[model samples]
Target: MTKNAIEVNNLTKKFKDFTAVDNLYLTVKEGEIFGFLGPNGAGKSTTIRMLCTLAQPTSGSAKVAGYDLIKDSAKIRQNIGLVAEKMIMYDRLTAAENLRFFGKLYSIPKQRLEERINELFQLVDMQEWKNTQINKFSTGMKQRINVIRALLPEPKILFMDEPTLGLDPQTTFSIRDITRQINQDGVTVILTTHAMTEAEALSDRVAIIDHGKIAALDTPENLKNMISQGDANVFGTKISNLTSELVNKIKSMDVVTAVAQQDDYNLKISAQGENALNEIIDTIRDEGGNIASVTNSNESTLEDVFLAVTGKQMRDQATEKATPVHHRHGPAPKARVR
Candidate 1:
């Protein structure tokens, strides 16, 4: 079996009476880009902080980059680069200066540090702006510099929290490409993001976290398949004025299982199969309901999986309260492991 690059067992953290993380377990393989997904208050940042050795886990044990999270935190820190969600760098310093500062902090030799800085500038496509002060940089540029600074030490593993949060589409694509390149260079990456599309695009595997625990963990394809399996053949029609009588009449059809109104005009009805669509239409027509447009709106996606599991969209769940809890033993909950 391949050895894991990072391992967490029963990891937990609490702040006062709130539990931020509860019995979280995870395993990231060497050279894999593991997407750690969750809403804003879902403890993603807290977990990354512990893994990066910036915050100790309140309970449980973890091993990162072959170093114990508690007993060998210093060693762990040396082996992993961290890019926090918030951009953190000196505004007065030039991008190149910031890289140099981080290189020195990591204790890179003077000669090697200069070479590494040059490489990082090229890696992040920031060589042209190397001499420009960070205060003059755009949000995307600052994010690129933040990542470069974290990578200065050539760590074996990287922890990135919302790395592309505020970036434009073009810049986000660039960052994603760079992340893939880094992983190709044999570095393991642990990333946290609320963007399902990004996770689906980049992760070798993804962990869906919610309520301070994992709701699902698997490859993106597998997670999406879970939602697909739950899908029923459904037909949606837009009517001028949907009413309770019309809804009940549609639900009473032989093939229709449920009927829901989208608004005053649109009605969505779930049916058993394709044949049911004709039956639904016949029934609606008999009732003198005129169909303006019909379409299938229940297509499965990563968003559907998230919604099915969390009962909310990733963006909406970000504002919920987050409580901290101590870690629990054993593997994390296996929702959709396949």
Candidate 2:
């Protein structure tokens, strides 16, 4: 039987009058790359902070790495690694120096630490640059180091926050390959990202959070199917002489749920009810739109699912309240595992 790496139940966080993570319940199975996606200010960061033991929750409970969230925080810290959005390393230190500094804090034995450092450097293909100063490295190089820094402690679970936020295409691909390799080595990963393609390609299961709550949770394919196979109808059309007026008219249609301009001549639309596509075509003809082509594909992207489920809801207004929680077990060691 597969074990669970993380379990959360009604985990809530509030700051004064505002709630950040509102009654969230979730479970991440061992050895799976779980995706945690949400729009801005949707409490993604706040929830991660609480699970990482960087912040405390207001109510409810959780178990991370089989340790109670509140009582066994120190144990939890020892068993997990964090790769935050920002790189955590010293600019002046060389790659090897930085890794050594962090490894020492974890109190790894001298010989074991040296072997682990070499193994990690080879895993990320950074052996040649081990002695090079971090200040001279490019963004991608720095990020690669950041990833391995989090692994020095040999954690069971890894929390990666926007692991590929601002990298070139090649670098992003390399990082993603590394992520898969790490997962294959039996490290459970909880990934929080805004990139739909990344989440769809990497996650075994995904949870979409909106307005401080889970709006949809399922496999990427299942979530997309909810938009394509359910009541919603997705249409892709191109007009040679597309105009803003025509786009506005389509948006005004009672049946149209979303009208996005792919370009000056192409539009992706979602609608509902019977005869909706025929009505859309008729309206385009009446409005002098020069039809180029149309396609009704059964396939849907994760982005489409995200927009369909959370687009119509009012935009999130609550700011993540960063309240520091005093841990009886003491704060996690700085840069020890992140």
Candidate 3:
């Protein structure tokens, strides 16, 4: 059996004059949580839509759960479950009813469907709300039901697009835990999010996309380390009355590349390496510059990666200021997982 759950080769999608997804190629291994990270208009959703067979690609090919995206769309649908940002359950129906309805649509046997509904309610910690009308449910409750509805068929591959967008911290944590549990049960997960912290915490590997193309792809730690290397080290002391003469003296020390005043009293000196750090400290003590704190301020984050590649925050382009990028869609946009 193939070890890959998803494979895309030179996948491209265009909308009139706009190239939504440029020639993109990616592979997701079976049972891995592959994170799709990108800014707004970076083509994350466009790629997901093409992979899910909701929209046809302008060029190239893809396969999901061993089903060809072009020729076996139905089979792909049968093996995949999609949970979008917005809850998509019928308001009038009870939570249990909503799950049963989608379960039937997937042709799950009646006995299995009932067992699945009970299991999902317990899984999401919403067993108490199972018989309650969805219209009366809170936003978090409704979202939980939406997730349950998507899992009705026990799909082999699950696609979650901004599953925790706009949710409270508690609710978001709960959702993250649920996702981990689902993956532990052997379901291959594809997650798309612009939230750097979320991607860092959940993803096994991340693909950073920008301007409809992938700029970098690797583990979060490797990406951080790549940017952290070759950074200048700086040391600081109390914010008070150090003069230009004192600054000039500090700069003359071995390995001290440069020295500049930070504020009213604080001074910033850049050094070549760890050796420079000790030289600066001894020089400061001899020169009578009282040290306050020392720290490495040049470290890079996922945000730095986004700015380096896309020149903007993923959430900055989202229409709703409060909504994460994975949930935002333009008018008349075709619906996919999220």
Candidate 4:
């Protein structure tokens, strides 16, 4: 039988006037990658803080690594390693010096720690850079060192909070591969990330949280299947003569649930009802839209499930820089949100 790595029962955290995590119950299986996903300010950090023994819960109880959250927090801490979103290391220290510092704090023997450090450096293929100062490293290089620093203690469970945030595509893929390798080596991983693609690719089971509660919990494919079995349908299309007036008219349709303009020529639509496609196509035709192509797919993505469950976009679009487009009618129109 598979033993649980972490378990919680009605875990809650509150400020004087606000509740951050509200009566949450959850469990993570041993040696599996569990993805915890939520929007910003959605209690993910608070829950992690509580489990990591950095913050006290307002009520309820949890067992991390088979130790009571309150009664054995030190034991729990000893059995878990945390990789925070922000890299934690001294910029002035060389990679070897930083690892030695952290290993000493964990009370590892000098000879064993040195051997382990060398082994890890080789594992990440960074042995040649071990003597280099962190200040001289690029963001990706620094992140790699940060990850190895957390592993020095050889904890049973690893809590990775946005380990690949702000990384280039190549670095992100490298980090993800590293995560899989770690899990294969018998470490249970709990990953929190905003990237739905990352979550789907890495997680064996995913839990979507919103407003301090679990909105849905299952394997990524199962969650996507929930969307596929529903009445909602997603469509992608390109229009040769797309305009703001046509876009607005489609948005006003009773069948349309959400509309996003991908580029000057392309649009992604989500709608329900039996005649959703007909209604949408008729609207486009009425508005003098020349349809270049249309694709209706029953296959649902993690992003699609996220929207259906949370009723909001997965990431904050306001922070992303929109590409400038040349529209036939006037200035480029901003993409509409549900």
Q: Please give the ranking of all candidate structures by lDDT, highest first, separated by commas.
A: 2, 4, 1, 3
TM-score sort, best first:
2, 4, 1, 3
Residue pairs whose backbone atoms clash in candidate 2 = none
**Greater-TM-score candidate between 1 and 2:** 2
lDDT of 1 by residue, 122-224 (tens): 8887778999999999888898899888899999999888889878999999889989999888889988886778888999999888877999999988886
Worst lDDT run of 10 residues, candidate 1, spans 329-338
Between candidates 1 and 4, the one scoring higher on TM-score is 4
Model 2 CA lDDT for position 79:
98
* Each prediction's TM-score versus the true structure: 0.77, 0.90, 0.75, 0.86
The top-ranked prediction according to TM-score is: 2
Please provide, for model 2 over 174-241, each residue's C-alpha lDDT reduced to its tens digit, 9 standing for 90 to 100. 99999999999999999999888999999999999977799999999888888887667888999999
What's the lDDT for candidate 1?
Answer: 0.79
Q: Give the Cα error of residue 207 in candidate 2, in Å.
A: 0.5
Candidate 4 residues 1-338, lDDT tens each? 99999999999887766777899999999999999998776788888888888787889999999998987777887899999989999999899999998888888888999999998898788999999999999999999998888899999999999999999999999999999999999999999998889999999999998878888999999998987777989899899999988888887888877676778999878789999999999889988999999999877788777766776333442222222322233432342221
Q: What's the residue-level lDDT of 146 in candidate 1? A: 91
Query: How do the residues 123-193 of candidate 3 rate in per-residue lDDT, one tens digit apiece?
Result: 99988888999899877778878877888889999999998888889888888899999999999999998
The deviation in Å at residue 288 for candidate 2 is 7.7
Deviating ranges (above 4 Å) for candidate 2: 239-252, 259-266, 281-292, 312-319, 330-338
Each model's lDDT comes to 0.79, 0.90, 0.76, 0.86
Clashes of 1: 8
Query: How accurate locally is residue 163 in candidate 4, as Cα lDDT from 0 to 100?
Result: 97
